[model samples]
Target: MTFTGGNPQEEPPRRVAKKSKKRFLWLALVTLLALIAVVLSVLYDRGEFDGLRRRLLYTKAQKDENGCAQLYRYASDQSGSFASLDGSLVSVSMHQVSVLDETGKTVYEQTVKFQSPALVRGAFRAAAYDVGGTSVYVLTAKGLACQVDTSGEILAVALNKDGYLTVTSNESGCKAAVRVYDASGQPVFAYRSADRFIMTAALSDDSRTLAAVTMGQSSGVFTSYVVFYRINSESALTTTALTGSLIYDLIPMGSRFCAVMEEQLCFLDDSGEVRAAYSCGSDYLRRVDCGDGYAALLLGRYRNGTQHRLVTVDSDGQVMASLDVDGEVLSMSAAGRYIAVLFSDRMVIYDKTLAECARLDAVSEARQVLMRADGSAVLAGSTAASLYLP
Candidate 1:
């Protein structure tokens, strides 16, 4: 009442206050919009907006009887060792690894040798297979592992399959013992572990990083700890522990995610943190693989009972899809756009969505199914092995 004219200073203060509130409101709105943008980006990156396509089906032709008969008759032939088998080329070994086209014509052949005597011994015990590419990995006895190229040269040699190797050409000058090699057989980077023995070792599809399990060894027992390492451009290394358990299997889900099986199924991040754990109902889990953002768990009973269950989950431990089968899944493989599920007498092909797309009656029990990156499959059993083209 006393200041009827309204003080000029008071007016200025009021104006400043109003302007400040307005500015804050605008800032808050911008922040909210930025948060929404980030969320949308994440969802898009996770493939949440992708549309589902219809599951396609294909008729099964009796596995080319002539081809099967040829492979069967040649299984024991010393001249028939596999150099490569995928797509249009099937390479067998006689004097050297021989490359052949689908029509049984020679394409390429080369002479390669094992690096170390230990490696050579391991090579003989290895189950060698080709990925339809220039690289080949040998899973050896004593758990020694190595990869070679088309030239049949040793690229990288791991003392044990659990990711320890010697890096040849890094800045560290082979001082860094835990190293990984590229497809060209060059030691690009190195890693270090806390434990001397590794229980499991899994290489990513890109081969940039390796997931491994180190174990504390006793007289006869071992306690396992899982870890991962990144191979960087500087040839330097960084490692992180993922979990502690008696790991039975480790499967990489891209470079950042991995499925680790101990007593329970656990999903781990690149840093080895457990993102999720699933209590596998069965006592024995034979194999596990992931694709299309889903994991396929193969469980078996001692009496030959088997089941195939597919679980799709996100990084947050949320289940997106679950598929179950009544029959025993004898063997399985996944690559590219398909998952090949091998049962006792039938071969079922499912898309990434876990929906059955194709079925074929097999001649005998399926022991192993090898899914190639090129969309072909090789089904090997106790009695027979046949290749399938999709």
Candidate 2:
């Protein structure tokens, strides 16, 4: 009678123990899953998966009948500059700078006063500074990377594709000073000139070479020179004498450099010797812009007329393409292998061969056109900016 049920009570206890074990295992599993989720969230917030996310989530923008998608609308200055950086829209105004993501979301905004604000874009970063002021800000797609307060007034600034910055300022003891900074805002190289004025300087794309345009006087005749230097040393690599109108732009194109002057476009090699020079030949240079390995020059027969020709020149100083522009060119931009030209009534996008890729009509509100590496263009208006997809 005492053990009559054949250990039925023992069976109940065994079943209870089995249920408890299963419950514990379920709790442990859930805890592990939660921890994994948290770690993934942190990584996402830190942008550790940005590249993968962008690739996996790539979606074509929904465009309207004008082949345009409104990116962002904000109160902005009419003369502000717009540039594309890492799939974000960077708008530089007189008193503020804003960055908007591809989804038309504001990612960063900073308020600063700038009398003559200018913006230049690299691959993933941008350099915004006052043309004649002391404040310089380096920005990325997320936010401001660094702010550089120079000891003197800022004259010109250049940002390479890798975010290397070159700032030419007016120092007290020298006619002009050129300072090069790495991506972290740390000064890596500095040179002060006492004999000639350094108009502007640019660091090569590889960050190994430096090119400076200097204006000097020889025999009471104004002379300009493209001086090349190694970033790690103080000695000049070579000096290519350029005697003519003032040099307006100096761009580093791989092993060579492209110098844009008032009257001609000169391409120089690493030895600082002119490889090829393209003269305007009766057509006056109206507007000039440099892209990846090519320069876009808008030349006109008359000083300020619609009878202009858009010319694309390669690093070898050869004309890659040319188009007769019959309309007034309001703004033009180049990136990768395409160029975007904004007219008073329309916008035209062309390939490197000057072939028409896409055109958007009735876009008179766009004040500027900024090309993306993917061939899309960002059209900036007075108070809003739109993305044009072809």
Candidate 3:
């Protein structure tokens, strides 16, 4: 009768109030921390801790004294699917193809608007190479190759020199062929194989040797054979098999060759003879460039990992130097005195001594790095491409 029990409703109200207060206090503390973070970020952006932040950012650009390298923003009008740099010129292709000079000015622009033959109705692939700084070799689909000047005019279609156009298509099961034409588009030599497929082909620098990878099949197993041939004429040549079992990459290293086959790094001579073979111990070899009497092999792990290794080897299969790198080495190009390595986020330029010359954040997703004959570097990225001059 005399209120032996407390007021239940009043006690419930006090408990609810205490919980609300605790939540409010927690939220207030979080808001204060966020405010402090914003303030710190603003200060950092305003150069309050610029030096410290730069160290953490690993910006080697500021340390470059000779300014032998620079970073430039390379934006393409279209999404770039392929990029190549030769000398101070950068070539990019996506919906169309264009060439940009060292000053970021368009030297040539051409829309790839050619219709393929009915027999070769597939997506076309293109590659551009600088012939002499004035002319470019444009290799396109259906064996349509052309040489264009810097002004975007066709100089020669279906080049007929000693080294002309050769195309290999897998349209027919394991049927491979090579068609050579003269500068006037006249067919000089044509060879077709009924047994195997020709995957790819490359000509030597001297234009006397022709290297190709041939695909062979037996009992559902796939194998590749590299054939080195003496290019006597477009029509008359002899090919000798070098190696078998899936040739992944073939690069002509001056008088010799370097290739990756089934995770093995192998070197071959001009006569299709194996010089040396070494286990790469990785899934794939990304790129190989020859310079300073050595080949720089960029090897990468297959899965998501940051471990990358750059190995330098002499022409005779001697290991010169090896360096562990941080990111995936995307592409590499070398010239007389420098080598430019393109990583995912950065571009490193090194001298013949393997000393770091300059490090720069890539303007975009770098797809290719080219060290020009003039000691400059060109970078081709996703959205843009740039040239770095010394």
lDDT by candidate, in order shown = 0.48, 0.84, 0.54
- State which candidate, 1 or 2, has the greater lDDT: 2
Of 1 and 3, the candidate ahead on lDDT is 3
For each candidate in turn, the TM-score is: 0.55, 0.83, 0.61
Error of 3 at 13 (Å): 99
Q: Sort all candidates by lDDT, best to worst.
A: 2, 3, 1
lDDT of 3: 0.54
Which model scores highest in TM-score?
Answer: 2
Residue 6 lDDT, candidate 3, scale 0-100: 77
Q: What TM-score does prediction 3 earn?
A: 0.61
Give the clashing pairs for model 3. 74-384, 74-385, 75-384, 160-182, 160-183, 224-246
- Per-residue error (Å), model 2, residue 243: 0.5
Q: How accurate is candidate 2 locally (lDDT)?
A: 0.84
- Pairs that collide in candidate 2 are none
**Local accuracy of candidate 3 as per-residue lDDT tens digits, 31-58:** 9999999988886544344335434433
Candidate 1, residues 292-349, lDDT tens digits: the string is: 4566556554435554456544434455555776676656766554577777777776
For model 3, the stretches where C-alpha displacement exceeds 4 angstroms are 1-78, 81-88, 103-105, 113-165, 170-174, 181-188, 217-222, 233-245, 282-284, 362-367
The TM-score of candidate 1 is 0.55
Worst 10 contiguous positions by lDDT, candidate 2: 46-55
Query: Local error of candidate 2 at 321, Å?
Result: 1.9
